[model samples]
Target: MRDLLPPGVHVAESFGDPPGAVLLPEEEPAVARAVDRRRREYTTVRHLARRALRCLGHGAAALPPGEDRAPRWPTGVVGALTHCDGYRAAAVADATVVASVGIDAEPHEALPEEALGGVALPEEREHLARLDAAHPEFRWDRLLFSAKESVYKAWYPVTGAWLGFEQAVLTFDPAGSFRARVLPEAVVPGGPVVFDGRWCVTRSFVTTAVVVTRPDAAPPAPCGCPAR
Candidate 1:
């Protein structure tokens, strides 16, 4: 999983075929309100996240839920968490090295056919179809949706703005990565930043990740935590 992440980032993953235990005190309230399945996923991902932080040299710490329901990391860290059937993972990086990061995992299966229209732009749909025709084995629609999710996760923290699926046009490469061009109206102060992402199909799941570094900010320092 670490191989799929960008430099300065680390990832930890777990399988859920036989669901793991839910043991985080910080997550107890949230888990108590969720159904059995959601509770299992929520707990597993948080566990993975805390472990990743530990590997980054931080001791055990509770990852509280943020205003947007994203995991709030400790100072100096920016990270993302994702979970799906049989897969749960978390990726984290020192904020000085990476501005933000987002990751998502989904079952390697077709998305619900009805969801296609709402989740993809017309251009994106056409691109997916072409890629599908070319590569026949991959579930292009599902991968596109996963990529969009990763884009949103990575975008939100930087701008604190909402991005719909149509706000960016996503294009994929045969090499298992993608680039997203922000639509004109969706441009921020950056005027339009291209988001780079990587995806891999493994262990019966498709996982996608995106990382953004602070190219425009002051030189890297260990004190800034955008996700905090």
Candidate 2:
């Protein structure tokens, strides 16, 4: 793999696979002056993401309504969407082959350790603390946040079971990338699937990416986790 990226990956990866393209709302200064500042940025990300999906031979048929919401791409296809201050990105693949996919990006900064109590499970908090103890300079908070997000994106598609943040604990190696196992060792109905993911941070931005494959399409192998 090249820098954690694979060869012969989806052609979409060519446009910056984990694509983040922007069509700014800079032209709407008048509308910007009238509406909440948020509407402008939101409009821009949606516009750019839609156009990008269209170029992929999927078009608006591959999009969801809310920018923060997941897309309603073609059946048997999985989709992931992400947005940051000035950019937004999305990914699409066969859903059956890919169990569930989740992608998240956030600015590189220490999230308030004290404030996330409601969302972070006790084991999750401790795991993050251990990671911090091991790597003082690395921002472990981003890892925890991204893990929860990956869990959400992956969970919804498989179990169709909505889970609270504390419902699962994310175990990562060193990067924000990791695997998720739901608590109490409960069966996921269809699977206790392998959640494969990757992430990166540069300058002031941090992003985490994940794609959980359904075992039905790519049956659970003895070796485990062959990334797409």
lDDT winner:
1
What TM-score number comes out for model 2? 0.70
Candidate 2 residue-wise lDDT, 12-106, digit = tens: 22112223433334324323554543544444444544543453345445233433344455555566656656445545555445656676666
Tens-place lDDT per residue, model 1, 91-190, is 8887877878989888889999789888888888889889999997888888889988998889988888888988899999978999998888888895
| Candidate 1 Cα errors over 4 Å, as ranges | 17-22, 216-228
lDDT: worst 10-residue window of model 1: 219-228
Estimated TM-score per prediction? 0.89, 0.70
Q: Which residue pairs come into collision in candidate 1? A: none
Which portions of model 2 miss their true places by more than 4 Å?
A: 1-37, 51-56, 60-62, 66-69, 185-187, 216-228
**lDDT, model 2:** 0.55
User: Would you list the C-alpha lDDT of every candidate in the order shown?
Assistant: 0.79, 0.55
Error of 2 at 2 (Å): 11
